[model samples]
Target: MTAILSMLPPDWREGTFLGRLDLGEGPVPVLLAGGTVHDMSGAAPTVADLVDLGAFDPAQGSVLGSAEDVLARAALLSPVDLQCIKAAGVTFAVSALERVIEERARGDADQAQAVRGGLEERIGGSIRSVVPGSAEAAALKAALIEDGMWSQYLEVAIGPDAEIFTKSPVLSTVGSGAVIGVRSDSDWNNPEPEIVILSDRHGKAVGAALGNDVNLRDFEGRSALLLGKAKDNNASCSIGPFVRLFDAGYTMAEIENAKVLLRIEGPEGFLLEGESRMAEISRPPLDLLRQAFSEHQYPDGIVLFLGTLFAPTQDRDTQGRGFTHKVGDVVTISSERLGTLVNTVATSRDAPAWETGISALYRNLAARGLIGGRA
Candidate 1:
């Protein structure tokens, strides 16, 4: 087992710290403190686990044993129930590279260049001030100096197949053990959500966690008109190590200072690495919360992958050197505040089949002004 390190609240460590672990007896909730595990077997057997117990307060129980002893015996479940994992659509972009990549993949050179030109022009590059026809015709500049690029991205919905296409956050699930299982090869996916904001029954932001909005680049590259295929799938998303509940004592400065580091490694060596600040996120966590539930509802709890600065993708210069994960690959998104989320790559064996016909319908609808953005 690879080691996962995160700051367990020092205060909670004395007595109140709690988590659920499977000790081969079955999945049991445990009270953790001082490197010890307090037995919660059959204890939560009725109203059951921590979430139902509310606040994770441990009922009086005998000490289970050393933390290592118990952890060694059990598998860790995601800290949150994860009824559904939702992504705020297009919340951030390193540049316009997302669409640019997809457009180029379609073998449409002019449109691809147009996408880049439009973005570069918005940031006021040396590119003719008028729209340049060729990559060489423009200076191609801008350093994320302006927030306007991605600040107003409209949230969209994600569906596993084309049938549920809509401009709203999509929901995907992870399998047991919090694995982001997928049928595609490793390099095909990317993760988002520099900050994972958690909300309660009323959709109010309540806690924070580390999350991976796993994306299948193959699906994404096929068409920008639809993100559902690339966005949602069984075990395509995962969150946790633990969640950091929001306290009144926490401040905006602390939130703004949060840093997200995306790291990936294969059987040989490091592959991709990038860092960004929470403040760079177009929608603040709180603001994203408001946008997320504006139309939908989550009675249990909701997870919002706020956004990210840039994704670690294949180099734009070399088409073949693209980004994708393979078997045995490990990807980790770490944050001091939210902790660390780690996933080892493995292609899902029994995943289901999905259709892409709906994307074409969505593109048609978008062009007719029936929906929000275009394809």
Candidate 2:
């Protein structure tokens, strides 16, 4: 395989150690040390020799094997060993031949051809108008590019009905690299635990932005006997922060202000008032969100939910209580600087037809002042 090497300065490999391969262009070489990659500049004897020694079967690139092997080799080498090869300076290289070969064998054109023929035969020309340029059409194009297989680039968070935590908020790190912890109770006390992932970005939270603590009350108060398996009985869950940070370019300060808002709607389509007799909170919506993220060490993002807002003791069987979310309930959340993000997650329950019934419900609700307009 043909290799391309990017050279560095004479002292680039001096006292620096290799961790893993960092793909970039710079004087600080990306070192493959201790099964990870890091950027550093120092003097080293022979950069080429070090690279060869760190090489291993790419197919064995699992977390335990190739990763461990890479780390082990770097740990065995001393500073003196690196200094002897300083004449070669430091250089980062990758096999161009291997990359090209992999691309041609798995490129987009070949897959699209295969699917286009089959789709045309089965569905006639119903799908021909759905070209791959538009945003909606891109999903099919992506699927075709991946050879009809489902591909996901983010980790999902899961928990029982009781746990309010989602996979998104917690930050998990190891050695240097990190990912967002999407699973519930991933690390109970760590507050912000490392999710153990390999990526190019640093200093970002992963998974969902925020989760509700109310989901965990039942489990926290229950007896040991009632808690079956610890994994099965947990409550609530979320995921994000990991891919979103890379995707959205979130900074630590920006993440701090992310928050959630809860709105309770009564039968008359008005917000329910808080009663003084109940345990009440008058904290501004943003304040509640800021405090939650700070207290839980949530790095960034918002996980807002607008569901039934009645207190637990309130009569849930009343007319308003029976009203689940409809198409018209307007939910709006905003930050001082971040503006607002709004969406409706409701659908008709008794709609027999797909298009007409659903559209009619939303139109009717809008007329009743349940949707549209400023919140």
- Predicted model with the maximum TM-score: 1
lDDT of 2 at 272: 28
Q: Which runs in model 2 stand beyond 4 Å of their true positions?
A: 1-250, 257-259, 262-267, 272-327, 348-375
TM-score of each: 0.67, 0.21
User: Per-residue lDDT of 118-141 in model 1, one digit per residue for the tens?
Assistant: 654554233123222233322232
lDDT of 2 at 289: 31
Residues 186-239 of candidate 2 have per-residue lDDT tens digits of 211001111111111121222112211122112211322222221121211111
lDDT of each model, Cα atoms only?
0.51, 0.24
| Residue runs of model 1 more than 4 Å from their true location after superposition | 4-18, 29-54, 59-66, 93-97, 100-118, 121-179, 185-188, 248-253, 314-321, 350-375
- What's each prediction's clash count? 11, 53
Worst 10 residues of 1 by lDDT: 154-163
